[model samples]
Target: MDNEGRESGHLMLITPERVFYAGLLGRPHQRCSGAFHVYVAIKGGLRLAAEGAVEGYSELAVVPPNLRHTIASDYRSVICVLIEPETVCVGALDLLAKRLAGAERQFFVGRIHAACEQLQHEPRDGDIFSSAFDIMCFGDALPRRILDARVVKAIAQIGRFSGDPVTAASCAAEAGLSSSRFLHLFKQETGISFRSFRAWKRARHLLHFANQDLNLAHLAQHIGYPDSTHFSHSIRRFYGLKPRAIFSGSRDLAIYRSGRAAAGDSAWTQEAG
Candidate 1:
């Protein structure tokens, strides 16, 4: 395992509700297919190509959930915040939809830029970063709670036991509801089916293992995949990248984890692959 407490330019802070990435932008082009991603150009503007539409230059961009998009930046550094849809309120989703629809542009500079600047300077202060992100993205520090009580319970269960084989039936049992009712409520509340949410969670959880020096089979099993094939396909479908590639790309990133260990505030330096 890589030793902890090494300082690096690249930083990644992972929380249950969101994931934040900052520092050297690395590759000129990046493509993703899952989650709602908010990208801010720290040094210069970026070029975005999504769904066959291209923007020549943009300081900030938002990619809606499951939308395949590519971001190209000439600048050496950028910051990204990935928020889960279930964690966002209807208003925030409305704003995001407008951006994704090309109805609005340049929505992230003022507050979000300040937050990114703070993160670049003090990468260890996860709370500050998260608060800033929430305000800039959702207009508040707390996400609006709109999910049904049972659906909320199921979502929490899926997040807590992501390594287990989480099925609608299992989650429904935890929420004290029938599988059919749980499925309906889950889709109605979250706007996505239970299976898709579980898949997204599993894929998102894979980022935690990115820095680990493990084989494909071991990594696959660690995330509850049945085999390497299933792992590769699932990751590609959700992230638009293969597991090996994602792991390889994350080798240089210094991970900062919250609500966990004291060593989570460490960093390490490595050239981008």
Candidate 2:
């Protein structure tokens, strides 16, 4: 596991609403992520900075949802955990962030590194869940969010078929609201606009093919992008690296996608509050 330059050191476990990555840290470019992101150093400390925010080296750092930031580690590999804002309560997420970057920092850093070593040897397709992942890292499952039913239905449609294009207007009709109204309710319920929510979903879909050998243009088209230009720009904007760089860095990455697939309408609607 100490062999940072080796391909075997890269691993990523991706679920429907969460991700855990112990892999390469590409150039430190500004990234505006849509999820609550936490970074932990494997060996040396990391430098984390955002415009108008504190900037320095730390063993662990937290970046809140939708914040533009840059993170770099002295070592080649780092551990990153991403929690989609829609899946957890605001208070719970904030507490998780604080604990990870606070007094419990060393404990989590050790647990995460140990977990990475164990996971690397497990079957790549084994079932993995956000709850299980949380327990492993934080010793408990984080609280879930209760969103409105109409918003839940919209989320289900957009996430059900990841590569398919879903329009706000279509979702609005299905939710029994006008486009304007649906847009308003979506932002109110999720704290994110409908367009941005969909865009983030599409960009996130790229993870499924991150370790594969595929054409960028075809992959872009496959994921509902209009063209390669738009695809590249979106990926860069969200991830801070170009598509080619991501694919290249992940060529040897062990990507685990098994777990809860997109929530079915029936499954999601039950949680509507």
Candidate 3:
């Protein structure tokens, strides 16, 4: 993973629960949705301005899920932790926001910074990265599971068959519930509708094929989209960036843990920039 002369730098470690990104902020401004984002400045801080939200500059900042925002930096590097909203408790999110917005902004202090520094030295160390993230975000143990068991099963089914055209009724059947009950419970547990959750999962699945040199249409179809237009819209809606922009920015990315496959000796490979 040499990034000496690359236009943009990206090193990503993707686990089942979260994705860790340590990269240079190349795009002046970009929008991201779906996951809760924690941004830490490695060299110099970045300026973040969100729609109808307060603008601020700090070494660390937390963005809540589904909020539209733009980030800008003068070619500075950053470390971003993207946690799945369902994996975290709602109370913890409030606590994290207060901690980041506090006067001192001590969320990035102590072990968090140390762990991020360690990842900067070795981005492919998934175990260390996961441990550090657990300590930084969850403290002692993983966050308490707040989703209902049926909803959890439905989520797993969505991940397993993301490429297939899975409908709410199908998921409901898998969870042994009626369509209405499943939809209601799903929204109550996840804070998002089943349709929205499915779309997010489909969009997030694009990370797996980011490094491949495939056509946008092919990539779209591979991820269960009907065509390129639908694919483009879904990606832009969720990621706030076009499919090509995402692919180009990820050219030098090295993926660490892909859930489809086990982490092996050659799990880390740098795509040609």
lDDT of each: 0.67, 0.82, 0.69
Total backbone collisions for each predicted model: 4, 0, 0
- Candidate 1 stretches greater than 4 Å from native: 1-7, 23-32, 52-56, 96-107, 125-133, 136-139, 260-273
- Per-residue lDDT of model 2, residues 1-273, tens digit only: 223324477888888888889888999999988988888898889999986888978888889888899999999889998888988865898888788878888888888777777777663456666667777767788877767888878887887655457899998898788899989989987889999998998898898889888999999988889999999999999999999999999877877786573334224444433
Write model 3 residue lDDT over 188-222, tens digit each, in one string.
Answer: 88888998888888898888777667889977887
State the weakest 10-residue window (summed lDDT) of model 3. Answer: 264-273
By TM-score, highest first, what's the ranking?
A: 2, 3, 1
Model 2 Cα displacement at 191 (Å)? 1.2
User: Residue 194 of candidate 2: its Cα lDDT?
Assistant: 94
The candidate scoring highest on lDDT is 2
TM-score of 2: 0.91
C-alpha RMSD of candidate 2 = 3.1
